[model samples]
Target: MTLDPEDSKLITLARAARARNEAAEGAAVRDETGRTYSATNIALESLTLSAVQVAAAMAVSSGARSLEAAALVTAGEGPSAADTAVTGELGAGALHVAGPDGVLRS
Candidate 1:
């Protein structure tokens, strides 16, 4: 699918986050106000949050009532249900999944 320049930029950010941490995944989201949030997966003994979940949570905590787009960069099959659910709750937008190379996977 063809994405606008902003969404493409989100993918780039997500890819960078993943590459920076050498983590399993990274994610970014654009809010209704055009603000963006980026995060990497957090897997700890006390807490575990997917990259997408963290990105969505960041938007929500930052007073974003809705999202315009979301993206995840991972080597897995696709994004998790938690990711989709968060996006659906915030807004009816597609979940763009990309590989480490910034190629959209889903």
Candidate 2:
């Protein structure tokens, strides 16, 4: 499938970010004021490109189609780690993009 210019740009940016991280030898974070940073920050930025790709593909192919059907057949089936990631707790029921109430408590 052909990629839109914006999507292409995002992918290029993602690749560049990956390359930069690799070049830094995975030094994705540094201590500045007795704080811990994470490579995940960069990784998440890079991940946005891929997510956009998925969204674009869905919009085009799923035209006039039911999202539920798409979810069942086209969308990758899996449990979302959102809950675990947000709650800092594992083995939770009903994987979701947000916590049980759709708000990530800080």
Candidate 3:
């Protein structure tokens, strides 16, 4: 698929997060203000969070009121229901899914 430059940037950011952390999943979100946030999945003994959730939280904590788009880079099929719910609450318009190879899947 031909993605907008901004969307492509999100995928690049997500891929970098995954590579840097050696994590199973990474996610990036673009807020309404055009700010982007990226994060890797958190999987500690006492806490677990999907990459998408972490990215969304980062956007929110950084004072983003709404989301314009989100991207996930994972070997898995797609983002979880919880991930969608969080982004939906933040008014995300699109959720882009990409493989570990950085190829857009959906």
Candidate 4:
């Protein structure tokens, strides 16, 4: 499937985050203002957060009231229910799924 340039950019950012951090998953979100935030999954002893959760938190902390879209890069089947829930709470209309290789799945 064809993706918009902006959506493609999100995939690129997410893929890079996963590779750079060597994390299980990476996620990126575009805010209503066109700002983008990206993060990798956090699995520390004291804290565990999905990539999408981290990305959404970053956007919220940075004054993003709502999200336009979100992207998740993972080798797993797809984003988990919790991942999609976070994006939904932030008002994201779409959640793009991609593999670690940066191929868009949905």
Lowest summed lDDT window (length 10), candidate 4: 84-93
Model 1 misplaced regions, further than 4 Å: none
- lDDT by residue (tens digit), candidate 1, 1-106: 7888999999998999898999899999999989999999999999999999999999999999999999999999888788889899999377889888888877
Candidate 4 lDDT tens digits, 1-106:
9989998999999999999999999999999999999999999999999999999999999999999999999999999899989999889989999999898899
Candidate 1 has an lDDT of 0.91
Residue ranges of candidate 2 with Cα displaced over 4 Å: 23-106
lDDT of 4 at 72: 98
Best by lDDT: 3
Q: Each model's TM-score?
A: 0.96, 0.26, 0.98, 0.97
Query: What's the true lDDT of residue 26 in model 2?
Result: 14
- Residue-level lDDT tens digits of model 2 in 3-103: 33432333343334334545221111111121211121123544632222232233334441211110100022322243123212311121122112212
Cα shift from native, residue 63, model 3 (Å): 0.4
Sequence-dependent TM-score of model 2: 0.26
State model 3's lDDT.
0.96
Per-residue accuracy of model 3 over 5-61 as CA lDDT, tens digit each: 999999999999999999999999999999999999999999999999999999999
What C-alpha lDDT do the candidate models reach, one value each? Answer: 0.91, 0.24, 0.96, 0.95
